[model samples]
Target chain A: MSVDPPVVHGHINGQVFSAAADATLLQVIRAAGLQVPTLCHLDGLTPVGACRLCLVAIEGHPKLEPACVTTVAEGMVVHTHTPELETYRRMAVELFFAEGNHVCAFCVANGSCELQDVAVEVGMDHSRFPYQYPQRHVDASHTQFSLDHHRCILCTRCVRVCDEIEGAHVWDVGYRGSACSIIAGLDQPWGEVAACTSCGKCVDVCPTGALFRKEDGTAEKHPHPERAAQLAEARHEHRWTNP
Target chain B: MATKPEPPAPHGLGDSLVERLHAVQQQHGYLPPEELQRLARAMARPLSEVMGVASFYHLFRLVPPGLHRCVVCRGTACFVRGSERLEASLRQRGVAFETASCVGACGQAPVLVLDGAVRSGDPGELPWL
Candidate 1:
């Protein structure tokens, strides 16, 4: 018999609740039906806390912490929504929009983009920061997938998923700060990468239209966010024994 | 005959990814993609992680520099003290120089480091200026 994980008591937005000790604050808040926005977080993948959208104010703490990575503990108080958090979240979303050439009208993930949905939910009508409009290139070298740097948010989700889950480290980031970009296999063009397995896992986890299948048309895309979780569950259950 | 102490081993996979890249840059003057790939294999790390670290730090150079690398400090103190003037003078001389966010020497305002030598003071005072 497997023992259950210990329960940790915590106050989220002033509501007391007990959650599995191993669960992150985001998971607890989500279980309690409180919506906390996230961009770089996906189930079944290690959290890098790259996106600052899920920052929550913990009582008695001077600095805000990301909900997705912070583990829950006893007597902890977390505020998921506040005016300050809303302002910061709005700016984070705006910066994402300003940093990249995210033209939603022409993007392949237009109606289904998590970034667009978050922007609308956060009430980002316009960007306060000036648009960078940096020149970026697109790579359609992969036989099945294409990468568009113009829409990438530098979240490292695809990078992490490809490395941790897919076991293929073909993708890497090149450059620093505002000029940083995702490169495949030593900054080579994607078509020439020999390590790529063409699994399409990166495309499924991409929050934006940055990675997409070659056959997908404009706004004709649907990413499977649960695929990774399902795969993890099957692996843990040893479902392959049926064969 | 006196024997010199053996030099430290070239930074390899056993060291932090950053140190390995630094060692590579120190040897090659800049990071080459082929060498990075070899380092990735030696270190058993993903190329993406290696590349990420390589690109994140300003100190790492991926491309070869010109014959001389002139770094001008652009910190607040230097900017206030007329670092721009020194940069302008260098530009007029038809010499290439790069602007650094800061040289960590605010007291020495308007500082310029040419070929790894630091110089400070009014733009016109320096012999080259």
Candidate 2:
């Protein structure tokens, strides 16, 4: 006897929808044609819930839950775009801008940056929180790519893509709190890390100007964020077509 | 063409990874790069993952320690008893010292470890002062 996967009925923004029992709230919300601002939630990659921008208010839950990691349940009432959620999402985007040196004018991913897009989506004109302006450095040691720590949001997209897809565990988060940054092979320079295959998957998946090609100047870099999902899907389906 | 010989495997340091790292740190006063690489290989984990865990904690020193080691406890109990003043004094004296969140000695508030010896007293009673 063939058994079908269980489907759960849920209400998103007061609209009823039926979704797979194991589907995440973000997936269900996206299927319902509702958009949720997310930075750390990338398709095909593991949902880490690092970014709180995708937080949605659920009935009976006191606190806003990250839609990327939250699973849909039967008879669940989810609100994706509430007034409080809008305020919070805008605040999160502003905090991201204030915490790091995201100078869009001189950035490589200025025209094609996810962080900038998210900021516009949330309508974050200015940040109320004081700008941190932490001292960060740029690592251009690699032959092809460069890493600007100032623009990095620590979304771990580069870390996950390199490890999960490329099968190269070259990148890892080092230090703690304010000192946290991505390190390559025991804090060595990117060029010095022998494990890196130089496949450029990390650079492709970077949401901001933090990782880009060395040859690219201001606003010249074009990141293909969908490459992760495409490559993951292709690998899973055993189809090696060009993305 | 001559094939390269495999490097000698590190001795089995037991199951606990952190304990093995602590043992290495204790022996070298810090975790050396070569030692960390060996430990990673022995544990069958990637070097980056091992380094990630080792570098996350403040206690794990990657660089060489100074000649005179001093650690001040900055826990709530210690902070309430003027550990900040003791730290300030140490800083003023140009003495390089590390800080621990808690040393599990709250009874002796404002505790300090001078070269691995735990002592709890007022800032004025410090030997450096």
Candidate 3:
């Protein structure tokens, strides 16, 4: 006989709720009808907590912890929204803008971009940090897709999806800070990587305009971020057809 | 005197793989594309993963090094003591060099490795000048 996982009681924003012991604070917050801005998080892929947008204040904790990775505990007090958290979240979103060339007007994922949505949620009117304006390039070597390094935020969503779900593992992060980028196999052109299955999973999961179909014009690319979660659920249930 | 401690190995890497990369670097003075592909095939790993590991570290050189290799230490101690002057001098002399985070010799501020010997002194008074 199988036993159910223990439920942990917690207080989110001073409201009491119960969740499975293994569930993360982010899951609990979402289930409580609360919202938290996130950039590097996806439903199906493993949570890397690379983006600091979802950091929340935990009682008795000196430092803020990422909600997506921090598991919920009994008597856990989580402040998803506070004045301090608001300041930090806004700053984090601003940094994302300053770090990359995110010109929403000319972006393929303009209207449908998560980064854009988070910026609005965080009320980021402008960035305080000076723009680096680093010279980045675009790779149109693939017949159907293209990668624009200028718009990439280094979230590693594409890298994780290709490796974890697709089993192709064609993408990997290369180099160090300030010089880091998502590289195809052996840092070669995307079209040259023999390991890639030509599946458009990476394009569908990208949260920004960094990866898009070659034929997509500005604001034309429509990503299906939910496909990853749906596919992961289907795979888990061993079901081949949509239920 | 306290005995020197062994440096910690790179994270998330197998000892044998690190050893193989070191051996290849020792033989070729750098990791060539063909050698990396061969190592990937031999190790039964993806080429991208191997390349990722190789490129992450500062010690591994993907391209060929210059005839005379000079490594200027850019660690906190050395940088505070003006390692940038040494780098500028090397650039002025048209000498090829690479910068390392630290060489474990903080006592000798503004240190540099000429060829293979560690030398520390005034940048202008150095032999490279």
Candidate 4:
């Protein structure tokens, strides 16, 4: 026999919210329709805390934590927005724009990109960090889609989808730190990977223009409209208690 | 030398599947259809939960994978449409061909790109290495 996972109740901004012990802070906040800014965290994949934008102040804890990865507990108090936390989030967004190539004017996902949307959400009108301007090539190998290295923020979204979600572990985070890039099957160029199924799932979940369909055309294409809804349904039905 | 294995990444990265794909497989190599439940536990999610997620997205592969992947789109526009021989042909070739949709290449029709390259047209086709 198995037992249901313990349920935890907590207050977010002073209102009582019910959550599972395993539910992450981000999950809880969003369930209550409260906003917490995030990047590098999508609905389906495991939390990697790579993007520190969702950082929130937890009562009694010394450091802010990524709401997406940090599970909630009984009596836990989380501060979603504070001046210090906002400053930190703003700084992270500034560095993200400065580090790689994020030219919204020339990008495919101009109006629909997550990185750009998050940048706006966090109020980053100007970037203070010096641009790294790494020389990366565009992998237009697949006729169906385009993988631009310059625009890649290395959030590992594409890599995770092809591996965990797609069941074809064809993608991988090739390097570490600011030098990281998503590689297709052992450094084989995009066209060389015999493993890619071309499902375009990676392209769909991408937060930026790093991965996009080839013929998206000069006209901007809207992102997944039902993505959040679909994710909500799936996670709610994730019933794991029948040993 | 004492680092614990990453403990398989939980299922349903949604669009962020690339981040946890290899990390999950490096711990298991291939994802078993039934393991979605265990994966949910690791991610602190539910099973019926991820299975719906696992089943809905084309990005999430449900079958076991080989060291090399051969995705054969059984779409109507592909050259293999009229003939009932494409699946057999791929099978006769001795490579397990996964049935995928659209692949976003309905125009090319009967095109079968290996890895990301079509069978033999040009291995050097794509420049983003």
As a TM-score, model 2 comes out at 0.91
User: What is the fnat score of candidate 1?
Assistant: 0.58
- Fraction of true inter-chain Cα contacts (below 8 Å) kept per model? 0.58, 0.47, 0.45, 0.00
Candidate 4 total steric clashes: 38
* B1-129: candidate 4 lDDT, tens digit per residue: 111135554554454433454355556655454455456556644333344344444555556666666666656676445313555655565766666665657666554556765542121332321
Regions of candidate 1 where Cα sits further than 4 Å from its true position: A1-3, A239-243, B1-14, B75-77, B92-94, B100-109, B119-129
Ranking according to DockQ, highest score first: 3, 1, 2, 4
Q: Backbone collision count in every prediction?
A: 1, 0, 0, 38
Candidate 3 segments whose C-alpha is farther than 4 A from its true place: A239-243, B1-15, B75-81, B102-109, B120-123, B126-129
Which one is best on DockQ?
Answer: 3
CAPRI verdict (incorrect, acceptable, medium, high) for model 3: acceptable
Write down the worst ten-residue block by lDDT for model 4 chain A.
Answer: A225-234
Give the distance in Å from residue A69's predicted Cα in candidate 1 to where it truly belongs.
Answer: 0.7
Candidates in order: C-alpha RMSD to true structure? 7.4, 7.2, 5.4, 18.3
- lDDT (Cα, tens digit) per residue for candidate 3, span A45-122: 888889989999999878998888888878888899999999999999888889888899999999999999999999
lDDT of 4 at A141: 83
> How close to the true structure is residue A159 of candidate 2, measured as C-alpha lDDT?
85
- What lDDT score goes with residue A151 in model 3? 93
Task: Write model 3 residue lDDT over B3-113, tens digit each, in one string.
Answer: 113335323345577778898999999999999999988877778888888899888889998888788999999989998887888788887788889998889989988
Q: List, residue by residue over A1-243, the lDDT tens digit for candidate 4.
A: 967779999788887899877778888999999998876787767567788988888888878888877888788888888999999999999998898888888888898888888888989999988988887888888878888888787777766666656666566665445656776654457776666788877887788888888888542755552353354455567643332
What ordering of candidates by lDDT runs from best to worst?
2, 3, 1, 4
* Worst window of 10 by summed lDDT in candidate 2 chain A: A234-243
Candidate 2 docking band: acceptable
